[model samples]
Target chain A: MNVPLIARLAKKDVRVTVREPYFFFYLAFPLLMTLVITVALGSLGGSVPSLGVCQDDAAAAYLSSSGAVDVATYPSIEAVREAVASGDRDGGLMAGEYYVLLYAGDTTSSERAALYAAVSSALAAASGSTETVDISVERLEPRGLSLQVRLIPFLVIIAAVVGGLIISSSLIEEREHHTLDALFVSPATPFDVIAAKALFGLFLGMVLGLLILGLNGALTSALVVVFLFFGVLFTIGIGLMAGVVMNSMTDLIARMKLFNIVLQFPALVILFPQIPSWLGMLFPTHYFIAPIISLTQEGAALGDVWWKLVVLVLCDAAVLVMAAKVLRRRMSGMLHLPSL
Target chain B: MTVDNPYKVRNTYVTGYSGSAHVMMIEATGLTYRYGDFVAVDDISFSVAEGEILGFLGPNGAGKSTTVKMLTGQLVPARGVATVLGTDVSRHPKAVHERIGVCFEEKNLYPRMTVRENLQFFADLFDRSVDVDELIRKVDLEKWASERAEALSKGMQQRVMVARALVNDPDVLFLDEPTSGLDPVSAEQIREIIRAEKTRGKTVFLTTHNMAEADALSDRVAFINEGRIVALDTPENLKLRLGRRLLRVRTRAGDDFAEEVLPLDDDATPDRMGALLRAGGIATVHTLEATLEEVFIQLTGRKL
Candidate 1:
């Protein structure tokens, strides 16, 4: 109800956090993780290795058109073998009635096998042979993101969880310092304190989220921002509850380690790709990460991901209400209310 | 003593005194609070008139802090009523809190913030546009206004806390051990501030274990012990009612000095002192009265 009081309290928290060394690390952790992942996976987008073809123009043309490999035509099989031996190409693809893959001594077996399969398939397609099974690969749309780009959503979710830690630590500091007693005596109510703290968490989470997205060159839209906001709110709710329940920084850090395992389910589900979708759907972060990935990587419109967004909002509301209740109870305890 | 009807509620406004029409700034009747099986504050009743300082003097764990908390709306009373500035603290805590200031015994300051920022932050809480620089100067913290609270000494921090309590120019101020640990000079400065608050027509409910502070700064003092008020009256009256008046005479006896005491109320006391002074060996003669601490020990059988 006291708007100015709430705003001033929130601003004070922001200033305090900015002065703390650990806060800077907490804020930059997500961005740093994204940067390391980007650099590590940057080599995955390197140009495809060129392949030497032995006088099979149709196979060479098909391989070149697919863009998965570059075709270098050789006049004879001996010429293709010479090219492979001399390391002019990664490997040589010789197409006849059947396909043969030639490789240097240093070439990996996996690469030789991959090139053989590609050349055989391309030759079969060009020859129009009924002997081979007629198969067509249909891609509805072009690839939306590289492996690194796909990591942006995961990092945003991470930033949100870190936001929770930031808020919890800040609040525990207030308790340890006994400033919370001063706040209670002031015109501000417990609700006002909780609101201000949650707002600070949201603000920090948004800043970190946008910075990570910008670093990865991922697209940002209103819907994506909304999704990130909900994620931040959910994590902040967890942080608020933890802040009220825990009395010391040590306890908070220990509990956050446990919450990390729980909150990481959505990120794990996305990272591994092997986890069942239904299992991921059970988590609140799943709704957040799913929609964010769709909007940021695939350029999906709001209408396409509206259901997930609705679910995310409902989940965040549930968490916030629970956190508010816990905070009120803890505040009453701090006031030294006699238990009935 | 327990009220049969412990929950009897009263109106916010009560009648004033006869001659000067005094308005009650703080009123509590039969206030009680219990911690599980232990009682922190028993059924105690007291009131503070406008522009009066009521010192709640007691030893540690004597329920002084609990009483202050109940009146300040920081804790709810298990029974009885409390009103601050005509607002029922139990029912309208925020309403009461908006008009009062409190300096807690614990140093609850923002360690990372400078002295000026701390005052400015609290002023914003009351939505008041106060001159923070002037407040800092008033507390004599202008030199350290730019320094963080954690970097200041305990005495300096106490001054900042006092300055913070006055940011809103509150109608009522509750100070819990305003000078618990400080040098004589620093303690004197705080005593001056308390006097200034009285001059500004603000009611102060000060809690402390220092008998001298209560005797010097309080218009009236309440002696509390074992979660109950043993006595409440003016400092002079309490000492006079239970304390003996004596005349001390110092004289030279043989190769050493000697002292003798005589009751001032006794008829033969003046003749005895005159005889000792007339003997020409009298070094000094003076009257002695009981201090508040002696009065407290006599009434409660325990030292402050």
Candidate 2:
């Protein structure tokens, strides 16, 4: 294994990929999905609501001290209204002739309720009324992640797995262009090419995966990184297999989309309560993100998902082994990959 | 270009075949290959000496490429030995690869990379220090060095492929259809480069169906058909033995010209042609030898 040769090949591939029109588009896939999820779940904010107040020092001081709601003091009542309308604050409270509670046009019903509660409580507590309604909130179904947090795994997969998709497409393009023949006849070995593609895919996927996770505010402990690695490995196998098996770019894309649809069943099962949980286990990637989802979102201990971690490894190994067999068989006639 | 023998065949006058004092660069002994039941390359033998161009001429699917594949160690011969550069090809393919350069018929270059970058990438692969600018200039790609390969015309791209083959300055070069599809000027330019490489003392194995190219470029030509070598010798010999056997003469027979076809190699040719000259007026005489294609057809009963 010539390390420099592999690095050179991988570096060329990265540069080539950057030149491809799809590079920016592929990189934007994670960002696009993140934006969609954020906008859809932004109104469902369970984090402390922020409110702007002006000419109402008592309410602002009370809200700030309450620790349940966040308060931002504005210079004037008009400033509070503008802040609320621009979505800088969730809602606003202002004192003109009388106290007024404001709501933005785009505020969801949930935000409206929170704004009403914040205003009422701040005004009541500010007036020295110690006795007030103590509301206790409980969920009918406990131990479930918010819809926004629940979709982070999906976004991470999208962000990281683009690398594998790029690898597979790059392989097919190489074949069509006959660059493989050029490389094989040179001092470079088939293994050098294969190793280069795999290495590039791993690095690309890892970077995008970490970036997406960070953007989503998902926890990135050692365990999450390990699971992300497994996820990327599984994707690389699928990507290489698809690239090797398909002869044309159109066919590769068609098949990859179908594969992606099937891979998303686990995400669907995790998101929708109506779907059966056991169904997601039928797919190999289910094991890949199951433990990570629990660790990052649910704060579950390792022992709780230890078996899942083992299953993830086994699944990754199985897919990677199958990919190797397929790759070797396909390249045998034209070239041969080195023993990894 | 004005040199009578522009091909610069170093050992053309050497009567002994494949044993010129010059080192043998490529030797295939009874080489044979099969694709399942189909015999792509039957038992064949040939050798090329250093600084010589051996044009393996044949039509598509005539085993020209198959033989090259074996000699290049891309395919294992079923029952023969392919010795290139004094080493068995199959046993030490890597060594052979390091020492030999090849330009495939297909212009397989990095489409997104510039001409200089493409050459640079291969130089890095060989792990040899190559002057990128010099290599680009070798292929006449200096003007297009910074232009992406895809942006260049097919002729320019093929030039880059040729340049890539010269990156390592290997002992032997396997050029498979170096100028398959190109304008006359571009093809001539490529041929000029091949001629230059020959002058630089590089052995070249050229494979193409274009007999004119074979006649113009090869020091020796091998006519391959049906996975077998029909004839292997200098083009002059092949043309003399098989071609130029027929002659057409026109003579006046009392104001009405009569035509007579004469076989130069036929025994009755002297009596038939002499009698015509004795009778007095010979109006016109036209004679030309058969082309390499016609010779190949005559030898193999098939056209290349």
Off by over 4 Å in 1: A43-146, A298-304, A337-340, B1-21, B277-280
Residue-level lDDT for B136 in candidate 1 = 91
What is the alpha-carbon RMSD of candidate 1 to the true structure?
9.0
lDDT of 1 by residue, A1-340 (tens): 6687779889988888788777878877787787788678652233455688866556677887877666788998879877776767767766555456655543322334455567667767787884663332211223223456556667887789877878888888888998878887788887687778878988888888877766665435777778888988899999988987897888887877787867878777766666776788888888888887766655478889999988989999999889877877776787673321
lDDT of 2 by residue, B1-304 (tens): 0112222242122323444587888988888898889999888887889899998999899999888888887788888899999999988788999999999988899999999999999999998999989988777879999999999999999989999999998889999998898999889888998899999999999999999999999989987878877777888877877776788898887869888788887999889888888887888877768799988877666766
Interface DockQ per candidate: 0.49, 0.35
Highest DockQ scorer: 1
Number of the top lDDT candidate: 2
Candidate 2 residue lDDT tens string, A5-73: 899999899889899887888888888887777767663235666778875467788788876667889
What is the alpha-carbon interface RMSD for each candidate?
A: 1.7, 2.4
Residue pairs in clash, model 1? none
